[model samples]
Target: MAKKKSPPETLLLLPKWPSSAPIVDTHTHLASTFEAYRTRYKDHATVFDMVRAFYHNTTVEALVDVWCEAPVRTVWREFADSALTPEDRTLKWGGIDYWFVMGVHPHEAQHYTDDIENDIIAAMSHPRCVGWGEMGLDYHYDNSPRDIQRSVFRRQLVHAVKLGKPLTIHTREADDDTELILKDLVPKDHKIHIHCFTDSPEFAQRLLDYFPNLYIGITGVITYATNTDTSTVIKNMIPSSLRILLETDAPFMVPANLYNSIPELKGKRLPISHSAMIPWTADFVAGLTEGKWDAERVMIEARENAKRVYGI
Candidate 1:
């Protein structure tokens, strides 16, 4: 049996707001994750609309929302294509405005070949596609052959290098392969992020050494301490100059506190976590990184690192 649900309480917020802090979300499948959230929440018009409405009448700082998504599914493509309007393309960050890493996820790699890569190349020319990825390997599930994943990943790396854009990687269990292939394929000037990092700090150090430009994306894993308990190790071991960014990896990797009573949350448990839940994850990082800094500082610095990486 499940525990009874209670209304969420708004906790006291942090102080020491940084004026120039980017507050930029390094990675988020805003439309992909938010729309699913709105649909399931039944009352919310997707997480984006709810957030937009909430901030509508309020004066706020700049926010960079990424267009990450699993465009492989026909349903995903149709829904996202229809939801994005001319104005929805950029969420108005600074006077210029922008979006984050936009690309076909590795799970959808098999559906494309050179021709499809060409088509995606054309689409990637979209003004908002500043970062290329969510396109690394995943050994946990051999959903697509390793060969196909590498081919498409290499194609995008080439495209990103040509476009002078940054790269965002998504690696699962295939970390060594990811590092090797990227070292061989990725360009020297490109910015990169190994999103949802939870490996040992040694692995984190190795990643930095191999890909000096790569940023470690700290997700909600810091809150769920067991097998995913590598955040502290990463914090202690990795250098700050490498630049660490925070991401929700929402619609998955929901933080522990939100569902602690569920029991199963002691390990991996994904039902339908929302992209808007980034705050909970961000707060978790603050606590894990020795709690030396306030929440605002963490958000600000992480955002600044993302902006530097994405050129936002």
Candidate 2:
């Protein structure tokens, strides 16, 4: 028999959620399709095994087909009146209403600079491209060179400022460099967020202080003790109005810390790409707010902050 790591329930690390609140899963890797799977095509899926399983196969129409288009037009056209393309889905909810961040990640940066630069230019001209992404240093992996990562990230930030779009940053064990670069390079108008922040409270506070436009995206990591500590610290440190955002970052970071998190997900490939995860993300935050979930609060706060940063 195999030894099982205690179930999340036994771990008792349910993330915050709200019963009354709807949600907004703000920062995700979904738009970043190639970054997730450019190297490994072992399964013949376009992206890596984790991402393909997560986001590619949702049944829901309102929020289905985030990264990849569902083959059947029927599933998408029900809630949204559009064809089965990612561009169609973005326009379905409301014409050009849905938005996403795009860029070459640190790892892929080495190989795809020229192509990604073109993509960024095209995205800048796009009416709905709202942000520059999950593009920052990851010394944790050092998958790309330090200088190159800095160059691509800086270029993207410059573009974001030029476009007046917000920026979503991701860093791991590169906090010192992250802070140093942001301080020196971030433009006055660059709306910024350090998403999935798992760093110390002191760091969070300092960032909040330095960049008034800076936002912190808290995720399911808040539900677990370790993740909770980070969230608690940020909440305590940052002001209530500083554009705090929430995200699932799925079909990657599955906030599976809930007791009822995935009751029906059994034996399912999970599609790993559900936007439906937003409500769960909301409930997770609401749970932390008062041990009960309120979707409304999450939606309002998240949207208001998002609108402020995104100007949408």
Candidate 3:
């Protein structure tokens, strides 16, 4: 019989925010892990895997889950239930308190229909739904035609404005068009955030000038030494912590520091990203600010900004 190989050592050197850090991951996708598990290992994936996948939530005080596409009914139900149930056991499990935003992603803009709109509107009535979006243009992919993406985004913007909810925006490579749409459709006083902001410093300045309450969402991508554009803007342009929101964009932009440094997570079929990675991001942001802002200060400001914008 072949001898069983010992498990590879997983590095645990990534920074951990204190339990009292008041951290709020302002944007993330929650259903990816379960969905992947269901698709690949439906028979073998146990409840334990689901729990382990979500065990990342232990790192943050609260989270803003973004539903960019229509989630299966059960996932939506579970999210709503988590928001309503607040027992100590749940809390001990690193039960993250949550608020959500829903909208059509630019890649899926062509698939948008009245039914989808109505479904989103109806979901807004759920006690946990607090904003509208993850919607905007993706000139890079152009998965949906530019015109169609713009039209779908505008319709959602109108609905969000009328509904009195904040906007969770997604703009990439089409900064001018995104700025034009926001200028034309969104109200000046409305709460708007550029989630996973990777735009130019000039564009950041333009939006900051145009929208008094606009906030920029920062994610673990900041940990990458190659991502100079965002790092430069964070370092030189955005001086005030008040205009920033910390996010994982998870199951997506797992930080370089966390991704490359972690030992146990190595040799995975795919890299896993989670809200628990936000502290690594917070630490990175502190370094970018040259200690002008520490991890605690960044987390505190982000929490307050999330509360004010999302009305949680």
Candidate 4:
């Protein structure tokens, strides 16, 4: 019998972005990323420690970390408070500007309650809190009943719209309902982000046509072999007219290209993704553009779009 070969050693290398342009990861889960790192290394590491290790040499200027839990993590206060000033951010987060968005995810829609909403509402007043969301429909899992998802989604939308905050949405396998609710509740000119979009190009076009300020959040998922929708959307849309934002959705979609770029990585996968990985996602997006754009252009455009949508 042939001996089973051992798997290639897993490696995590920082992206070689090839440019000095600063990038902002418009959507990520920082605390979740920290937790993933802690789990992988089995060390009692601080978020600051993770930041220093992963982001020291990268051109990651800022990140919009997400907080979409039901009861709202208490540590959110620590994260938000730390980003209140430049001095504080420099000291705690390695000078990476930290902004956050708060909401209850569609998966947690069943756990939505009045008190929980109050906490999210109060977070909107925090200077470091840039938006409200990641709240939308997720029929793919249907972790919560569809009706409950819709109710909680709309309730959160009402609060976010009333507060005049930007939106970071999460929609999957429920494009029709997501579209209906968004069109019905959200203003046409509202700053909206369809985070980690993997829906069809037609749906993307419709949303783009309706919402002038809405930008599609692209992640490392675009580099996957199994995904064509994301690349199709990039190809069909004119690069000059691209309304897209680069995000990692970190601790989730580590760009598949990372594995291919480094010889030592072989078939191993990174345990977590972070803001510094935006350039890899940008590089993949550039490939989809058929030479019309490059990694640096993608980074610059995404940074501009992040400012337009989140004002960060």
lDDT values of the candidates? 0.59, 0.56, 0.75, 0.88
Clashes of each: 2, 26, 3, 0
TM-score of each: 0.74, 0.69, 0.85, 0.95
List, residue by residue over 1-312, the lDDT tens digit for candidate 1. Answer: 985432221111122233333344456555555555554344455544444543332223333344434443333334334334545533532122335456667787787666656545665665555666667787778788988887877777777778877777878877778778887877654688878776666667776776667778876677775745466554664335326777766546766665543443345344444333455566666665574655556667776777678765
Number of the top-ranking candidate, with TM-score as the measure: 4
Candidate scoring better on lDDT of 2 and 3: 3
- Please rank every candidate by lDDT, starting with the best: 4, 3, 1, 2
Which ten contiguous residues of candidate 4 have the minimum total lDDT?
4-13
TM-score: the better of candidates 3 and 4: 4
Give the total clashing residue pairs for model 2.
26
Clashes of 1: 2
Off by over 4 Å in 1: 1-22, 45-48, 54-98, 237-242, 258-276
Model 3 ranges off by over 4 Å: 1-19, 36-59, 70-74, 88-94, 237-239, 259-270
What TM-score number comes out for model 3? 0.85
Measured with C-alpha atoms, the lDDT of residue 96 in candidate 2 is 23
The predicted structure with the larger lDDT, 1 or 3, is 3
Q: Over the full model, what C-alpha lDDT does candidate 1 score relative to the true structure? A: 0.59
State the TM-score for model 1: 0.74
Decide which is better by TM-score, 2 or 3.
3
Evaluate candidate 3 by giving its C-alpha RMSD to the native, one decimal: 4.3
